[model samples]
Target: MTAAITATKAFGATSTTDEVLEGVNLAGKRVLVTGVSAGLGVETARALAAHGAEVVGAARDLGKAKGATEKAFGKTNGLTLVELDLASFASVRAAADGLVADGRRFDLVICNAGVMATPSGKTADGFETQFGTNHLGHFTFVNRIASLMRPGARLVNLSSAGHQMSDVDLDDPNFERTPYDPWAAYGRSKTANILFAVEFDRRHRERGIRAAAVHPGGIQTELSHHLDDDARRRMTEVVEELARRPGARPFSYKSIPQGAATSVWAAVVGKADEVGGRYCEDCHVAETIDAEGFTFAGVRPYALDPEHAKALWAKSEAMVGERFP
Candidate 1:
């Protein structure tokens, strides 16, 4: 998995979302990007809409999202403001069904919303909050809308480098028997994102649909909202320590636009057509983690296994009591 796939490649980590989209125009294309109130989510939606794509800003609060969209686009034409609380399966179904009822067949679906390091708690569906919201919610949302994905549609799941922390423990996904480590929970969900994309592509590639998982690199964003002040301080300290370590890759913190680059690239860039299932970062297909930056780069073998991906997809379907065509 550490080997890089160079079949098609373009921009790199420093590319901004706008840059990756420089000559492309998504005019008349319809796209849906979740968690669009701020950070990479807002930038992603803005970038797409700026290029004439009719974008949907799916957020937890329609009011905040309206204001955010207005501020980003100056006017929200081609931007449909909608509510989607990923912590609730009911909410995910309602949002998808609402889109379906409205006759929206999305050209692109970006599962960009996620939570990180949440304290012990359960989502409205009584699943672990981080795992449920970040993985199961998107899992249900994507499957429920699979039939609506037109031929050649693209689906991007926002996974993370944090995925390296753990794989999905199907036998104990809720941590009822094992100790619940927030980081581990987050890792499992992120891994699920990758697994989801792998299986989705396997199932639908023949229909011209493409699915990809993206790690947007380290960008300071609202994904950390669940962390308390003390936890935030500790997280910062740990990263700073990693930064100071000899031979470590420089801690390159991307601006929101930069963070949004890869997701948009995966969604609209022509280069991604042949690159499904593999993980990407910094707007390009990542390379192997060399000794110097061995800590970052490329997908772990476990995360990229097609069998593992299919297994997780089947398990997720069973968990949500739904099926993807």
Candidate 2:
């Protein structure tokens, strides 16, 4: 099926939060956004709350999240903060359970929290740090609360163009057998984000729920905190290469507001339903990347394969030791 919204709206690569959300009213709508301590997460929550949506901001530290929200959004009435640390399965379960007990039906859930290229480490459950926190953490959290989502709810997984870096290695997701590369691990986790959304939409759309993965474009966010000097230099070289490609969109950094635009659009845009299971960027369903030129901004074909998505979903369930619809 074609995308419900194939063309970009008034917003573009440079558009800000208020600009993208102009004319939208979300009064009484309940939403959840992860990683609200700073950067895109804070701007996302602030912008949505400004538009009248009741936003629940999840962070690893409740104090930081509350302070950040207040600093960014200024004591908004509809915004609340919750503690969530994606590295620990127990934390993920407890956070979901708390939300469930609150009894608030969420209309949208944005899995925006993730780690970047970090040193090799294992999570509380013994999974690779990047894969565990970025994909598995959100995976278990969403499944635990899937039933609590209101019908027609939107699930937005914050994927990345870095998904082009690698496909998920299901057999060794924790890098037990193969040597670990930080960027490769991060890429696999990002790819898992897309695959998760693809399979999630397949399973849940019939029940009035839909999921989509989003690439928020190049932005300076705390997600890059783990990037050392060498890593940053390599990333710069890649961006420079992309910038030199013929017909490639110019590589540029986005303000936090601009970076948060696509996620907000996916969450509340009217035509978002048409692109369920699709990867989105710049406020629209992104094109598939061509094998010859990786400069174009779009998803890689492997990230959207239904078979791969399904396989990854099963693998994820096994890792988490739980079954989910």
Candidate 3:
């Protein structure tokens, strides 16, 4: 399967992150962005900080994160670095516990750190690498920090259009019974991200907490670290071949800043006040797509199924051995 293509107008397709957020003032607002050491994470943090938000840059490597913060903010006072490695449940617990202990409130929590197709690997907690860090890890983190998010707070899960590749297989999510394919595993994790938002919103919307899953348009980033040079080259060829196919709508690749647009928009947009549990792409709520292949576009029906959302939530709780409010 290909990416989920959406026709919805992007709020800032060609615009840089700073431009889309030009007039928004996040002064005194507190934001924490995972994966902030580089790529879209840095862009997201930079945009928030540029708008005067007190940005907490969370990454696995504190040193790299600090350096990235400096590069983005230039020794500014608005950004701080926090250590977080989502693959380790202990790390997630420690990070959230620290925040909870601080008695601080957060306006936004961007669950942005994620891994792509990689060789079969397990997290410190014995879960699949991508699913562990991308979905279940974020799930545990959000639950721990739920009390810290004030009413009207936003939680953004960085999902991908790659979700179209597959749905959550509750019976064998860790690939114990089924054969493991890197892309399939990634797709399942991405689907978990969407369902997490759906279930979270269903439970928390009345509390004024909303959740959104977003597909940042593809950009050349470090998120593909799991792919070797040969694999990367093959993917590049795939994209090029798909682009050249007759009548094929070329995939619109975004620059790093543009790739971060949808995330920033979902995070800070005033208009998104009532929007929750929806999958968004290109900065707007995506349409539903039924077809497959590289040109595949929009959210599929299964992706938005409330029943599946509940089921996935229950399964996730059992898998992670934690409950979320």
- In order, how many clashes per candidate? 0, 0, 2
Best by TM-score: 2
Write one digit per residue (lDDT tens) for candidate 1, span 265-297: 888774545567677887766553423222545
Better of 1 and 2 by lDDT: 2
Score every model by TM-score: 0.92, 0.95, 0.92
Backbone clash pairs for candidate 2 read none
Give a tens-digit lDDT track for model 2, residues 193-308.
99999999999998888899998989998889899898898789889998887787778898899999999877777364666989989988888875743453888999999999
lDDT of 3 by residue, 1-325 (tens): 0111233333645666765676676787898899988899988988888778888878999988888778876885788777889999999999989989988898898988899988788999999888998998889988898898877788889998779878889998889999888888888999999999998888887888888888887888889888977667856776787788888776777898888988877777624444488887777778878776644457877888999999999998998788666
Off by over 4 Å in 3: 1-12, 244-246, 294-296
Off by over 4 Å in 2: 1-8, 292-296
Clash number for candidate 2 = 0
Cα deviation at 168, candidate 2, in Å, is 0.5
